[model samples]
Target: MVDRRLFDIARWSLMVAVWLLPVLYVFGLMRLLHLENAYHTCTQARFGVPDDRGLPVFGRLDSDVLPPRSVCTWVDGYTLDRVPWFVTPTMFVCLVVAAAASPVVISARRRGVMAGTARRPW
Candidate 1:
């Protein structure tokens, strides 16, 4: 049997985490976008040439969400550059944790365990 105070503390912590997920995601996405922009700027400065429209004619940028890659690819399918190693993995872990926690929190709320006013059957 779990102590009531301990259980309430755990529930409150989980609630806080679930509430913060959106803010975390937004910040993570902003960081990812910033990194991607930096990658593009660097690639352009290194390999791009100004065409008629004055735009850098560097390689195209590509990205993947699951693995979280922002790659600059050349015309001939060569990889020019990519974002830092740490950002993507950190974001992935956060996303995974948020996904795992949502269901548990939702179930607890639905079962009235999170309300603190309901009695446990057990």
Candidate 2:
């Protein structure tokens, strides 16, 4: 048996979180759309991110050009191996929790066991 109060809290929390899916989806799309264009410059110049290690990178303009992007060009390459602070994980968690908890809550309420009472799923 579980505490009815705790169960209610979890059920409502999951419901609220699941309701944010649309907002999160919109926010994710907005973020992707607002990103600056990297393939071309605003002034009609071809720009590209280069892959350079200990060697010089080349641009599309001239193959003879030893380097394409300067040191300042390749900024913001900090990619840590961790979960992004985006809506992806949050939305996933919400969906999973809601899916798992909805059946339990509904069945409990229907069985006349959840009328302000605690009942464990059997």
Candidate 3:
């Protein structure tokens, strides 16, 4: 039989971790949103060109006069957006913590059930 105190601690830990999952998710989602917004801002601030539709067009226009006497232009707007501090690490930590803690929770639940069954009056 496992120590009751240890069981309690493990059970509580799992509960706390489970509760923390949503908080972690919120933080991660916020971080991602902020990164996306920053990307949008920076993109518009840098290679943003005002198109005929009044939309910010990203990328550079390359004009080549030696290519069969034709002008060519291409839009290049693929880059890694900068995320705020602790976003990536926190995300990873949250994911790992949740994943690791889940098994612990399951074990605790199984133990609790077993303990309950063992104590049955019948």
lDDT tens per residue, model 2, 14-82: 678777866766655543331343223211221333324443332222111111111112223322211
Clashing pairs in 2: none
Q: How many residue pairs clash (N, CA or C atoms closer than 3 angstroms) in each of the candidate models, in the order given?
A: 0, 0, 0
Sorted by TM-score, highest first, which candidate order results? 2, 1, 3
**How well is each residue in 10-107 modelled by candidate 1, as lDDT tens digits?**
55655665666555455445434643354455455455632224434455666565455656655455664345566556555656665665666666
Clashing pairs in 3: none
Candidate 2: worst-modelled 10 consecutive residues by lDDT: 62-71
Cα lDDT of model 3 by residue, 89-118, tens digit: 555565676676566656656656525643
Clashing pairs in 1: none
TM-score of 3: 0.41
For model 2, the superposed segments whose C-alpha errors exceed 4 Å read 1-3, 34-84, 113-122
Clashes of 3: 0
Compared with the true structure, all predictions reach lDDT values of 0.54, 0.47, 0.46
List the RMSD of every prediction in angstroms: 6.5, 11.2, 12.3
| TM-score of model 2 (CA atoms) | 0.47
* Runs of candidate 1 exceeding 4 Å displacement: 1-40, 43-68, 73-82, 120-122
